[model samples]
Every structure is written in structure tokens, then in C-alpha cells.
Target: MTRTIRLRFFASVREAVGIAQEELALPDEVRTVGQVRSLLVARGGVWADALAEGRALRMAYNQQMTGADTPVGEGGEVAFFPPVTGG
Candidate 1:
């Protein structure tokens, strides 16, 4: 079965991906935010470096801050971005 979800990229992640948002059908193994990142990383090159595990990134589910383990359901929305700092 395939799970369809909306993905949103912000700031640097958006610049890297060259898109602000897109919809994708995820495979069965990808059920959480972390899994989605893993799948993107598997794309290698820019994707790998952008969403690399070592990168300091933040995530949200349906506009609510969430951890990597957060569950994602069909038609869900996920956003990725770098930590925000203001002085």
C-alpha cells in the first residue's frame, strides 16, 4: 500500500530542494518523519546532504512541531526546515 502525504520545505531546505511544496506517495517502510528523511537521503547528492542526519533540522506535522518519530497518516502534511535563531 502507498501512503500519500504533502511535503513542505522551508528556508535552506526549500532552496536546496528547489521547491516549496510537493505531494508524494511513500512506501510502506516510511511511516514517520525520520523514515521520510531516510527515504529522501537515499536519493543521494543534494538530497543526502540537505537532509543528512548530521544536519540540524526541524520538523512539523500538520503545522505542529513534532519529533522525527511522529507518525504520519494519509493526506498528512510534513515540513522540514533549519532551526530558527533571532537576536
Candidate 2:
């Protein structure tokens, strides 16, 4: 069954999407954080440009920072944010 996942974007990603979050229904094959990012990129235009592989992106799964291989399950909140900056 397709699962609905929430995607939250911050910093540049947020600016690009003109929003902070999106709800998506994904298939079982999309089991990792990288897959989710890839799926969003396939939406084209802003999604593609913002999530480009060359860009630096930080991710979180269910509010906990995570790596690309992190598993994502139904009802999880996956967030994408730009590299942190503090000085």
C-alpha cells in the first residue's frame, strides 16, 4: 500500500518550493531518505533544481537528523534543510 509521508523543507529549499511541507503518497519501493529526495526531484522545475545532487542538503526523519540510507516508513516526517550556518 502507498504510504503518505510529509516532507518539510528549510532555508533555500523552502524558498524554492514556496512552502515548508508537502504530503506525498509513495510506493513501498521508496524505502529510503534518498529515494524520497529523488522522487521530489522528479516533480521537475523547482523541485529538481532545489534538490540537485550537487547541492548540500541536511535531512531529518521524524525530527531526528538522518543519512540518505535512513529508512522511511508510513506517517514519517522527513525534513530537508540547507547546510547549517552559525557564527
Candidate 3:
């Protein structure tokens, strides 16, 4: 089954991806947030670099912080951003 997800990019991630938000439909194999990242990375170029493995990117599903292994579902909203830092 396909899952329709709303993707949100923030801060530097937004700058790198060059979009604030968009809707994506995932293939059944793309079940986890990390898989979604992989799909995007497969696009190559900036996407591959910005969300590449080992990068210090943060993820959120439905406004709550999430990990790579978290399962994604229908109508879910996922966000990606760099780790927050405060002085």
C-alpha cells in the first residue's frame, strides 16, 4: 500500500532542499522515516548531500521528534531539519 506523506523541511534543510513542504506518495517498501530519507537521497545532488547517511539531521513525524526506524503511515507529516543549537 502507498502512504501519502506531507514533507516539511526547516532551516538549513529547507535551504538545501529548496522547498518548505510538499506531498509525497511512498511505495510500500518505503515504510520507515529513514527509507523516506533514502528515497529522497536517491534523487541525488543536494538531496543526497543534505540528508545523506551520517549527517546530523533531525527528523519528526506529526510534530513529534522521531527516529529513523519509526514507521510511517498514511497521511503522516514528516519534517527534517538540522539539530537545534542554542547559545
lDDT against the true structure, each candidate:
0.94, 0.92, 0.95
lDDT of 3 by residue, 1-87 (tens): 667999999999999989999999999899999999999999999999999999999999999999999999999999999999999
Q: How close is every model to the real structure, measured as TM-score? A: 0.96, 0.94, 0.97
Q: Output the better candidate (1/3) by TM-score.
A: 3
In terms of lDDT, the poorest run of 10 residues in model 1 is: 37-46
Q: Mind sharing the TM-score for model 2?
A: 0.94
As a whole number from 0 to 100, the lDDT of residue 43 in candidate 1 is: 90
Model 1 lDDT, residue 82, Cα: 100
Q: List residue ranges in candidate 1 displaced over 4 A.
A: none
lDDT of 1 by residue, 12-58 (tens): 99999888999999999899999998998999988898999999999
Q: Can you write out model 2's per-residue Cα lDDT over 4-85, one digit (the tens) per residue?
A: 9998989888999899988989978899999999988998999999998888999899999999999999999999999888
Residue 65 shift from truth in candidate 2, angstroms? 0.8
Off by over 4 Å in 3: none
Model 1 RMSD in angstroms: 0.7
